[model samples]
Target: MNKATLASALGSPSAFGQSQFAFMRGNAFEARVKADGGAELLRLVHERLDPEAPPPKGGAVPDLGASGPEGRTARTALALREATGTGGWTLLDHPLLALDVAGSPAFLEPDAVVVHPDGSWTVVEIKSFPMLDGSADAAKVGAAARQSAVYVLALEQVAAHVDPAPRVRHTVLLVCPKDFSNLPTASAVDVRKQRSVTRRQLERLTRIEEIADSLPEGTCFAPDLPPDRLTAAVESVPATYAPECLSACELAFHCRDRARAQDAVTSLGRSLRAELGGLTTVGSVLAAARGESGDPDDPAVAALRRAAALRSEALGGVAAPRAAAEAVPCP
Candidate 1:
């Protein structure tokens, strides 16, 4: 089994060293939601997704069956930490955290952890990309920050159980080399904003818990459900909605096929933007489809309309049928 795929499927950790894909499939099906294009697409994606149905010939060379320089970067980070003999912090690579919320649960895990002698703790997330140049993009950094916040929230639980020293608050991402031969760079991060966002996410998480609690008895999660199903549910997002999820999303072949059938959105999380139906998209929809009338006299809505219009006009028609109306012109 592809460990990265399974970790993604089961909402488990993304450890290169770990080789487990047990609950991935069942978890994937169970994670289907109407908002995310439903389970049918997920099933279709999974069914058609495998590039390598046959087992790979290589022995232990491919850790977790992950690919690209990013995969090696993750594995090598583990090796380098041990090689450096750095013991100040807890090294949690692709770790999973199960956070308790009044009986229901939420999970958060970051790639690495470092406990300073001064008692403060930092969460280390490893990504394979250059931190320099335009390599460190906003959306990617947001993803890293969002993922790291889970660790800090989970660490809060540890704080309650063990003797309190310093809270795990900061996040540090270790970016992979743009050039393979070069050393990986460490990018320190403050995910306090992520923490704030997490607070809101937990509110939504709590809602999901309520939904699950009301479900029928025999209709529990699938066979491949991870230890904490809720977190697993959150993480088991399929490639269709989350094609940019990770370096080794097992269902890529399927997702690419699906995306190719549709029009491409190359700037940032274009596909994901289509999926979420949030501010950016809603704004776009209003501008293009609705045209000038999409904006209410409300100042905020009008500004958004103007911006969407400007974007459409600037793109010179390459954007899309509806994407043209994304950010409308301001009044």
Candidate 2:
């Protein structure tokens, strides 16, 4: 079931809604960049990624409209083939590409893609963030790079079917507002490392069919189901909840409540959870730290005990349950 729908059923809808002003700003920036048949976009791509090639006079902006995602993907492929054969610059605006993810196909529509004169392809990512003094926020840039990597991976799948497969450039063009102005600026972000890591991670995911088969028989997660039934259905499937899920998963808040109730160490974050080792709950970790339980030979338990003792000594031997609780990692 869709996590967003399940989250709504549980009365804890996702808190990741985009701001209206930010959304409008982003749309405006994208429109400006793609204006005049993508004249500015082509200039940025040429200046940042293909300076040596003849300055782009104009490029074909093909009509990729179709019935559905599948039809659009097919049209994109055909357009790519034709563009490569003609050996000219072409801009594929919002082209849909498919990538197999966990035994299912995920269709992704990137902002734009440029076919170079040399038959190479470049992914373009446009953002509203300002490029101040020739640079933008590093964190935002890194996030864009990772996102572009996914598009690059999808493009590679499409390229494989082409007769003379075109090279999908690892360095993508990132277009953003120029120094507080609406004018666009571009940067070439190398995403080879991000692409490799994303591909490996996607490959490691367990198939959806395997996970569904493991669920209880007759389990249903329809949004209209009773709250109790929907909750049970969702809980029947195990999940590893981490703080990072807040930004990515619609069910993050629901999972966080359950994790906190169970004193699951993962509620704090993955790093702290890893450090706690076998002590997967706050209560157990505290007991082991107080030397009231747990094997002394266990390194994690020993470290916790030592840290607790040091904290007590620093407090001049006063019983500090509150302090201990405060020091404990939890949501």
Candidate 3:
């Protein structure tokens, strides 16, 4: 079964996007770079990664292609081992690396990996985002960094299995379009910070086995089940919902609706929840703001009351009176 279904079962399904133009463009650019025995890519690696060292006259583009993912991954590992032993410049195009994430193996396919003459491997990340005038969007670059960090982590795991473990460089090559042209511009992005963050986050994740063990007996998440049964099965597992989940999760809408119906304060945003202190519900906050019931000594309640008074004063004869009249009385 696909890991996506497993993720959905764990209450973290991803949303699908309609347009794949950007992905296509990225693939096209990557193909362009790898064309002609990856001559252009070799040039970029020489210029950006190792300007002082001698450039690769002509490198081996070993085809590690196989039938299935596991077969291909095995082929990649063998190719990596061979490349490291030879101590030559080798490009493993679309090499797969498997990392143990939260007691599960997550296979990562990097754009490319360059094995230096010194047996050190560098992760290459190709992005469609243009680097205009030697600069790209900071946020886009950061996202790319995080992604490369994951690749680096996976590479390290593979390196561990090999004899005389190869060094995985912390600085990854980031290739992007130069200005508006199809030409590729390369930069070495240091992903040490991102690597640490990703490693820590992955380490902190709860194991899928542990989550599965916590589920109620006979609970099922089969898609063909009745609507009510499916909903009940899903609801049997707890989900921590927030606005940021909307971008990453397919079940965000369902979680959002449930949260709003229950008046969960976290649905607003994490920052708001932090600011509101003990006032966890919207109704409770509003009641405190209206001076109905709440500890006056609480800083959040006092601030709410102050803000409410200021708003009432500013709109004294206008929207405030009408809104107050129409509003439901505090229970």
How many clashes show up in model 2? 0
Candidate 1: worst 10 consecutive residues by lDDT?
55-64
- Per-candidate Cα lDDT values, in order, are 0.46, 0.89, 0.83
In candidate 2, which residue ranges exceed 4 Å CA deviation? Answer: 315-319, 325-331
Estimate the TM-score of every prediction.
Answer: 0.42, 0.95, 0.88
Best by lDDT: 2
Candidate 3: stretches off by over 4 Å: 1-15, 18-20, 312-331
Model 2's alpha-carbon lDDT is 0.89
Error of 2 at 117 (Å): 0.5
Looking at model 3, residue 305 earns an lDDT score of 72
| Top model number, TM-score | 2
**Model 1, backbone clash pairs (residues 3+ apart or across chains), number:** 14
Which residue pairs clash within candidate 2? none
Which candidate, 2 or 3, has the higher lDDT?
2
Write one digit per residue (lDDT tens) for candidate 1, span 212-293. Answer: 5666554434536654673344334433434454454543443454444454332235554543233344434454344544
**TM-score of candidate 3 against the unseen true structure:** 0.88
